[model samples]
Target: MQQISINTPALLFPAITLLMLAYTNRFLALATLIRNLHTKYKQGQEDRNLLRQQIKNLRRRLLLIKQMQASGITSFFCCVLCMLFFYIGYEGWAYGIFGLSLGFLLLSLVLSLNEIYISTKALEIELKDME
Candidate 1:
């Protein structure tokens, strides 16, 4: 097995940061969409069934995004902790923490993929409504 080092975990820092930024952008865009939907629903500008379906989809997507962010943040934290452990000469602990960090990052990516699938499904729903 390749020996773990502080640099190994540090490499994830930039990638994780970028992922978090992307996730935050996704969240902000979703929030804007939700607000727009709310306004349209309030003004009765859209069909009730379509709006309700969209709202349901948005709720699920929102929850998924929240989970993705949490897992990503946890991964980032674990990476930092891993580095700290290595710096302090706890090679064993550092290796374990690094593994955990990778696991969390994998989970976050999976959640992001699921959210993307759901997002596309939502778009399909809208298109179907139009048809």
Candidate 2:
């Protein structure tokens, strides 16, 4: 059996890393916004500012959630394609593709979870303000 080339797997590592970075970036941004909201809530009396921030956060997070879900779905399909390559490429490029796709799948799932958590938190905060 011919050995698979390292290049095959190597190509995937960077793509997966980029996806992970994207997920982390979104999470960091959300955290920052939440912290800012907390600061505004404690330091001043302008409820409007806090409310506006919350609303904006919620809107952005909702968009992020949708994007995460879509990315997750796409990653899954890529994984399937990778598996197919394993057979088609006979444990060479296919295996490499599989590894890359798997990483993408994991990253997408993590992003999806992050988006969902942020969205739920936003919804919870909104509910707390109901009059």
lDDT tens per residue, model 1, 30-96: 9999999888878989998888889889999999999999999999999999999999999989989
TM-score each candidate: 0.98, 0.50
lDDT of all predictions, in order shown?
0.95, 0.64
TM value for model 1: 0.98
Q: Write the per-residue lDDT of candidate 2 for residues 1-131, one digit (tens) a residue.
A: 54655354445545655765766676677778677776776787447855786868667785775576466556655655665666566665666656566666666677677767776777777677764
Q: Which stretches of model 1 miss by more than 4 angstroms?
A: none
lDDT of 2 at 7: 56
- Candidate 1's displacement at residue 122, Å, is 0.5
Candidate 2 has a TM-score of 0.50
Clashes of 2: 1
C-alpha lDDT of candidate 1 relative to the true structure:
0.95
Runs of candidate 2 exceeding 4 Å displacement: 1-51
